[model samples]
Target: MCGTCGCGEEGTVSIRKPGEDTGEHTHSHSHAHDHQGHAHEHSHQHKHAHSHAHEGHQQHHESSHGHEHGGNGHHHRHEREIQLEIDVMQKNNLLAERNRGYFEAKQILALNLVSSPGSGKTSLLEKTIKDFKSQKKIYIIEGDQQTMNDADRIEKAGAPVVQVNTGSGCHLDADMINKAVKILEVEDHSLLFIENVGNLVCPSLFNLGEQKRVVIVSTTEGEDKPIKYPNMFQSSDVCIINKTDLLPYLDFDLEKMKEYALRVNHQLEFIEISVKNGEGLNKWYAWLKNLSL
Candidate 1:
């Protein structure tokens, strides 16, 4: 009897010796035993042993395919990715070197002014231009995120000015200044002031071929500015504390601010000025005149 087909269920097969009785019970019992043996052999070969090996091999192949996709999938195209990431900063640095050489060739003293938005940098420049109009030929490169307002003010003060709108860049890089320099008539032995975009952080990292870096800090700003933004203070050659006339109206601690600044940069020169009142600008003019000599 076949195990899967259940052929013994229809009828019993009789098998007897020559003189023995042929019993249906004996025949049915023997057929059931043969069916059970067949089932065991079939299960061992196909369902239990073979299925487990096939499943394990399929899992191993899938794991190997996943690993290949995850590791070194871009090995053949790594060179193109590296070329795309070639340093943008290196190009800016080279332009800065060229601008420095150009400044040297023209014999012009350039100053890059850096500060926050309302540090009165433009007001200070206007006052400086007015004070030194007869002493020096002043030229300005105005950098801002938007309009030509600062450049207009400088021009009304009777100085040659060029405005650079950086669109959305946070700071003016050396390449921007190099292009702006060509627009302005920078005579030999003139004072070229580059009013950098009103940002304290990013502007300090860029050198715009300036002989001096001046940072403008106002009395309205807290006295702890020197310590909070130490990089700007440390990079500056001159620190101008603008709006000193407001000292009586505000609770500003001048001595502490100066102390912190000197601690950060021992060689930093400082000037106190109020462009509105025309006070303390003489000292600033004197410093610029000395630079030219």
Candidate 2:
């Protein structure tokens, strides 16, 4: 299991291009197997002894002391769990820095787009690709737990794309991008959009070495999403408010959403767009263009 999130078991990730054989790209974990075929995980089992003593002398205590001793063990276990999470994050961050250096050397403008499921992320990408393909060379890395649906759509949209099916993984890690780059071979001085798994919580914790992180929120969802998922808002550089065309028929408050997002991330830049009718898309395109400058 992932030490950071306790997510998918190892060996559950797969990366492939559209129309490729499904069985060719599974990522496997290296684990030893016993005679019974049980996977043996190498882990350190530490037994911690918590002794409550006064001045190095053993204290003879009753039920109250027993409760205190048990509580100490629980707190100690919690600390170990937190430390394990930190170690996992640090390792991922190191890999992310390596990916960042690669992108810098190649002059690749990589953007990681994250949002909840059905938040119009894919629609925004389709619109962006169709409208801006003439001006900028674009490529895509689509992330999902299963299916090549988004990658197929992006390929049809006129860009070379790769699909990363992370089986039970909740977020795309730096190693996945490093592998996808080899297959996609994104061109220099081009934009690479990584459509992360449709998740708000776990994706916020994993950095795929993108130059910018964009969070999409739709009018159909709660306006208080920023406060509910503050880490996502704080980590993202841009907030794209999609489905504005449905605002008149819905009870969504646009200004309040912006206010809440700004409260979480004062540095966040907002662009309101509706992919269905092409409203405010020019502003989104303009933002993309300015990134190259």
Candidate 3:
């Protein structure tokens, strides 16, 4: 569920390559769920609580599932929400550490690319794969609510790609990647690009055990975006200021955008690139190269 918009169902993650044999590589988690009486999730779009009715509570059971005050069993909703968040994140963090260890043992570089919709993440990836596919093996795990459109784009760019259809979910968690990695049969000493669901808030709260988190933002969206979505920026290791090729026709100020982002995260590294026309992308390629060193 998106912490910002509460827009996900308590469900499983599905992973498959577009046009691949279902018998060979098909995985789904339809039965997975939390056991906490009434579990709620937060999405990037909104905050809505999802509840499930449970038995064995000492309080009087209301038909409407509302909490009525009782002698010794009434608990505050706010406290419940806090506890839910802690439980969700704690489980995710443990799995994320496992993922980190797995990648470390294989000498794989996993990078999580997070951003809002239409941030040009796919284009940047296509360009990266086209250039470096020969130099190193690159695997892509594309996350979207539905459809394999982005996965298709990455595949045509000549890279190994898997699509994770999150159904109503707004972000991908570490466990989902664990399943994808098994199907991907990823190679060692390679790059694994996890293009997380197009979200700025919910994805920030879920870590996938990636070595670095790259937040992509375009100039057309204006510089205030970083300030508006500070949580995403603060957690990210680097910020990619994309669409520099359109800077001449627009009123976007590059310096101010970085300033606003830096206000939230003082240590974030910035990369200015025009993935469309190949401007200022050497730093990006160079950065990736240095990661292996």
Off by over 4 Å in 3: 1-12, 21-88
Clashing residue pairs, candidate 2? none
Best by TM-score: 2
Residue-by-residue lDDT tens digits, candidate 3, 1-293: 33223444443446888786441332233322542323422321112221333344324333324554344232323323233435647767988999999999999999999999999999999999998777779999999988889999999999989999876778888888888889899999999999999989889999999999999999889789889999999999999999999999999999999999999999999999999899989999999989976
Candidate with better TM-score, 1 vs 3: 3
Question: How many angstroms is residue 144 displaced in model 1 relative to the true structure, after the best TM-score fit?
Answer: 0.6
What TM-score would every model get versus the actual structure?
A: 0.70, 0.79, 0.77
Candidate-wise lDDT, in order = 0.76, 0.82, 0.83
Sort by lDDT, best first. 3, 2, 1
Q: Model 2 — which ten-residue stretch has the worst lDDT?
A: 39-48
1-293, model 1: which lDDT tens digit per residue? 52212443533322111223432212212366677899668644544444345433654444444333334332121112234756656666788889888888888889999999999989888888888878888988887866667877888898888776554456777767776777575799888998998988888877777889999999999999988999999999999999999999999999999999999999999999988897899899889989988
lDDT of 1 at 279: 86
What TM-score would candidate 3 get against the native? 0.77
Candidate 2, residues 1-293, lDDT tens digits: the string is: 43323454454677888888763465533333332253122111222233332233223222224443333333222121233435657767888899899999988999999999999888788878899989889999999989999989988888898999887778888888888988898888899999999999989998889999999999999999999999999999999999999999999999999999999999999999899999999999889999966
